[model samples]
Target: MMCLKTMMVCSLRQQILPILGLLLIIECIISLKLLELRVPSHVPLGTRAELSCSWQLGEHDVLYSVKWYKDGREFFRHVPRDLEPRRKFPLPGVDVETFDTSGGNVTLSPAVLETGGRYRCEVSGERPLFPTVSDHADMLVVVLPDHGPMISGFRSRYRTGDRVQVNCTSGRSRPATQLAWYINGEPAPASAVQSAIDKKTEDLETTSMALDFVVQETDFKKNGLKIKCLATLAPVYWRSNEESALKEKAISNQLLRSSLEDVKVTRADRVLANSAEFTNSWRHVVLLLCSMPNLFLRGLVWFPFFLQEI
Candidate 1:
């Protein structure tokens, strides 16, 4: 009985081993996998965008078809066995210029604002199994500004306690650009930033934001303050404009004028002191002459006697 039990266990092990080996072989034979899908995260409007899909297949498998989808709807298809290997279906904002069947690449000329969405690529193997592999990525069609942000309404100089009112405007874009203000290399406080304004013209949009704050002593760095306006169009565009304002010199000029006046007063005091000293010396000379009256009388008598002897 023990021998029979041992034989039954051996039979079961043999059956399972063969089934597992067969399954491994089948898995190795059916290898259709997507390697990579290249989709640009951001594409500028009115420019060409190229998307690529790459895959790998087993030695025995052949590629059956490759399809591209936008927002879950198929837009392009390629079948090597068909009479027309490349075909495009109509999709809004999707313009298929050329399709490369060999490399699974699709090119879109002049991408528009509506072209931004989820993109997917599907690849299938030929014949019996028809194994399919797929991948997806998101894209955004952007309208970038032609220039950097513009700053206005800023004074060339500012003083402590003076109100500063300035506006930053971004160039036209698809979605309004985001604007930010930085004072002396730091982000401005929420209270300093006013409500943002958006101006739309046709399909493009422009953004403007105002900054209003009182100049503080701490805002000055090295006798100047830096004001910067940063504009961004998410994931793609970034630009900034900066202006430097000098600290007002009114106080310093006043101090300088006071110092000059003090110097002038000191000079005048010195001149007056010299004049008083000179007057005192002249008074002493007059008193000495008055004290020498007898000498003057002797000189007069001697002058008469000397004149008679001559």
Candidate 2:
């Protein structure tokens, strides 16, 4: 199967919030199913990686402890200590630079081929597997992307602060893929993307890897004003996802916030029981918003692309 690595351009504003009363109750009953043990299935040489892992307890029970291991050894750890539950990797031999406790994910920077190997994880609380959920997760490492990235978009020029931006987007047919953006011809920080696209093929799923940032006039004059997005492909298919071009304007804060609020969380944690499960088209919306200024000059556009978040 083919998979695409997307460097999505957006933030957690689109995160789904848990709100249902009855379904929340159901989540309470199946706490053991809270998370599945999973890894990138593939890694690359000299790059960061977030090895994702999760487990669940019945809604009636509370998460007690979670730990990750690389080849039968401890690397990352999370525990429900006292009144607070949090993720931690305090092991001396283990290494982790980016791990979001709320997301139940581990981040490793400058990941390498040597990093490729078998990985194990355990999650436990008050049950049969309360103290240990087995190896369930795997990790693989490979070569990284050859070139920086390729830039694609509808237009090349924009007035100062007009919201005209570019999308550094790419597609993949496999996992173990790495994708990201470059600013003024240099690599920039990673931005989370909230998106969704339709899947039409079975062994050829398209993953949109893109980077979106506010544009500046200097960006165009630089070396090539080349806005590029790159993705590294793995031989495995995490699952089927939709295809998309990551070159749309930014979505209005009001419209986006409204849409996000409308989304429903299907788990017990009414506030954020949902992890980053939903697929997203964060770039499309952002690209769409940035183009509004051009539309306004031509006539009138209803969406406010230039509106700043309050």
Candidate 3:
């Protein structure tokens, strides 16, 4: 019975030995992953670039050292040995123009194209083996285009008393649209409006704004009688375009009066219709007192009452 118990204990230890060995290796890998690096991260074309790297090993080591590298080149290495056999660090690889190890963060200014590359951070411990490493991020550059809102509608001449429409149209614009009306080069107040038309199809545009207003005589005579509909696209897609589109027209007093006269004369020229109003207006009542001098004084032709009524 004692031999059986001893055999079981030895078998259990044999199984645990391999598991413990694997656990130790996993612990080492986890410790390496815990040590991290920091970098300024991104870069853009035609602009300065910066990279950074850092690691923290709590109260135990006092964060012994930090290093910065680009591609396979070493730029800077930092280490503090004052604390107990804590950490040993090596300088960065080549390929960098300057190795700045004097500051907490490795800063690269007045940057250039070559400054844009992968940055690596390596950390070491005076007592521990295998350096902890990580890489910073890469960046991209972008280009932009001129974009804005377009003006449409309100293209033709409109006279006083005429119903007219104006629209602010656009595409590829950012923010929103700015629409206004100008009369004779002066800003006109925005009036009550109708719903904007926004249709973005292969055959249609993205957005359209409309304003409907009645015209008046003053809108035609003075101020040169010019009207303009303007659209200023928002900054996101719109570059600046400082020109006002101009449309002009003239309304003469003669034209307005002639139009009214044509309406009157045409009505006056029509043949009278057979209606009650027509009968009342065109029906002329006649009262002729028949006291002809040729007839005897006060003498009258004898006529039946019915004929007199007729």
In terms of TM-score, which candidate is strongest?
A: 1
In candidate 1, stretches whose alpha carbon ends up further than 4 angstroms from where it belongs are: 1-30, 101-103, 250-310
Can you write out model 3's per-residue Cα lDDT over 46-79, one digit (the tens) per residue? Answer: 3444444545443333344555556655566666
**Tens digit of lDDT per residue, candidate 1, span 44-82?**
888888999999988778889999999999999989899
**Estimated TM-score per prediction?**
0.69, 0.34, 0.36
| Candidate 3 Cα errors over 4 Å, as ranges | 1-7, 31-48, 54-65, 81-104, 124-133, 139-310
Residue-by-residue lDDT tens digits, candidate 2, 1-310 = 1222232222222232333544554455444664565677765556566666666555467676776777777766676574555444454334687777643677776665557667776766654334445555566655533333345553544444444344443342323244555454566555523242323244333434444455565555432344444454545322221212233344689998777666643333554423333223566676787878687565544345445432
lDDT of each: 0.90, 0.52, 0.50
RMSD of each: 10.9, 39.3, 18.1
Candidate 2 or 3, higher lDDT? 2
C-alpha lDDT (0 to 100) for residue 80 of candidate 2: 55
Best by lDDT: 1
**Pairwise lDDT winner, candidates 1 and 2:** 1
In candidate 1, residue 178 scores what lDDT?
Answer: 94
